[model samples]
Target: MSDAYNSSWFAEKLTDRSIRGIALETSALIRAGALPVGAKLPPIRDLAFSLGVSPATISEAWSELRRQKIITGRGRNGTWVSGDSFVAKPERLASVGHYGAGVLDLTMAVPDRALLPALGNALVHAVSTEKLNSYERSRILPELEADVRRTWPYEAEAFLATNGGYNAVYTLIHALVPPGAAVAIEEPTGMRLLDILEDHGARIVPVVCDSDGPLPASLRQAMLSKPVAFIFQPRLHSVTGQTVATRRMAELAEELRDTDVLIIEDDGLADISDAPRQSLGRVFPDRVIHILSYSKTLGPDLRLAVLSSTRLIIEQIQSYRSFSSGWTSRILQGAAAWLLRDETTAEGLKEARRLYQARRDNLVRALAERDVIVPSGGGLCAWVPVASEPFALVTLAARGIAVHPGKKFAVQPTHHLRVATSNLTDRYEEVANAIALAASGG
Candidate 1:
């Protein structure tokens, strides 16, 4: 845009910043009128050279600005500030378009039902010829708990079975996280997780991540606010399918080394994930809470997951649950355990994992062919970086494609939107073309 940088305050604020910090300060400059809305930012190389920082830093700063709606990319026309402090973008659900038959929805993360085996068979096998009367039994049945525990990377003194992972999250947030406290979460997290956290009266502090998962610097920055817990999806991370590298997980564990911060690993996709499940729980077993949900793997109707945690948290959950729904039904527990050992179900799950991986991988390749930022793999969804969230949302929606706006999941400003790839098994090119157009300032 401009070779002659007008803002003297810009370079001054560039000191002591991770790329994200630099972006935040540039936003401050725009809000203060140093770089007024509609004014073009200085050329990336020029600003980076002027500030003695990398051009990548300037690029990331510009990206983060666009994400916040503080700036807009006008293709070859160049980038310009687009909004002011008082004119922040609204967070409203856009009305869905009715494209009827050809419409493809990439919003929800659910699997293709046709790929899974018959849950009726599993349930029938579980309930058939069994004594159905149980007046007194542990909230978590002993046999089911033991079976689920065998899959965990680490051992727990006691296990708690919840209706599902989200239920377990609610239990944890209510019982563990003190009200009015703040918790750390991955930026661009699930919208429902945000709701649960807010419902339980917890403030959110986001940690920015790359494909390998949350950056160590971002984690360090997030912890600076002293959040009460770190709730992150370690594997098959929804919307991105980003499984944290073992080395990166080790780094994260080291960061929480001496802290009291509770770490919750949301292993949502469970056995459906192509990657071998890895957890930071092994690093700090006493301080970690691991939840593995099977709804995506078996059948959503099962509503079951294994919650592995320390005795203290387990007891707290039980005590809190005593006055509520009591416990997960023993029948559902039996069904889940029975399904886990079912040969046909196991083969179907294996195939489902392959199909999800293929779709996700193909979508990533398709998007990348068009030069869209495709940070994905090992999950049912993909995260595509865009210059503007609203522009992408509207542009894609108008093309008979539906997807969640990236801003809906952002705790801080970010420039990416999630696309559920599983349903696009046969429409990769079509969806990718639409995304490329939208991301190109449609």
Candidate 2:
């Protein structure tokens, strides 16, 4: 070890011995220039011995630092002060490569702007919402709750409105999951989901998925780790676009029956997916938390999503939220409620679903004609198997097209690309040819 890894000096600088304390003190030291970037940290055992604390404490503190990107390296390589900053980058989201001008970007799994329902009338109706501008935080508008309840998969004990689907997931996880706790989520899930889990330092246990949805056997094996929660897209998976069949839902519920783990069902596609919404919430009402997002069906600007669970869990998430925004924008919630209840919006949603499915089908059929078979699941994107992620990415870029690498959405290695088909309104054959070529690493 170099003189920079002076255990005695480092130990003296750490007055607080608790995990949080050690992490904070170390961060302060690095920011204050006491520990310069590139300086190697003392080994866990040596630092713990010097500070009169357990090695576990030192290890956890280091883990927190690593999560914040303040330190780098692990195991035999030795830990080093990588940076003086304190921001935790969402690794997966950041890794989704950027595209330049003229590149046909098919990376983001988002709804086509042209298909989104008009929000003008909804916003106009929102002006009449009761207690419109009150400072008092309301968990959700009464009208909104009633509208959501009419379609809720179960008789939820309570409901809480949030900024959007991702916000609801992030808030709930932050409120319930402690650092390093295991969380089982569907494999090849939305990249944003993985980002949230990693940002909170949760040990992500991937539940592998098949065509019907998450495989029960994989979920059972993941449960062996005793994860705090099991999250999945029930209606339509945002990544693979596969819907969890009713039978699969029952099997998943059965696999989780013995455990008290929280069940989080994210219905991200909302009305855009034709599949009937399914939830394990009906089976385990007290433990299940269901989130329904209208971003795709209505408009992303609505910034509204609703979550339902037992009053206790809802209250916990609301309390955590109080520390920040306190409450979601009522205007957005009211607009969403208006849109949900409007007949015109209903028709628009039906049309949007038809159009998106058509786009997805067109891409699938086009690919099939070129000897590339991809699942025609319902969603804004399609997962296409590839010979190599890197080679496929390079091949697509060479053809002025861009797509997300499958590795961005999975914990395990995957050779695939997530191509956005929502806006693939025309030239399907042309784009499909490029994709098929990329898939074959040509």
Per-candidate Cα lDDT values, in order, are 0.78, 0.90
TM for every model, in the order presented, reads 0.75, 0.98
Q: List per-candidate RMSD values in Å.
A: 12.8, 1.2
User: In candidate 2, what are the lDDT values of residues 117-138, reduced to their tens digit?
Assistant: 7878888999989888898889
The TM-score between candidate 1 and the true structure equals: 0.75
Cα RMSD, model 2: 1.2
Best by TM-score: 2
Of candidate 2, the 10-residue stretch with the lowest lDDT total is 1-10
Clashes of each: 0, 0
Q: List ranges where model 2 is wrong by over 4 Å.
A: none
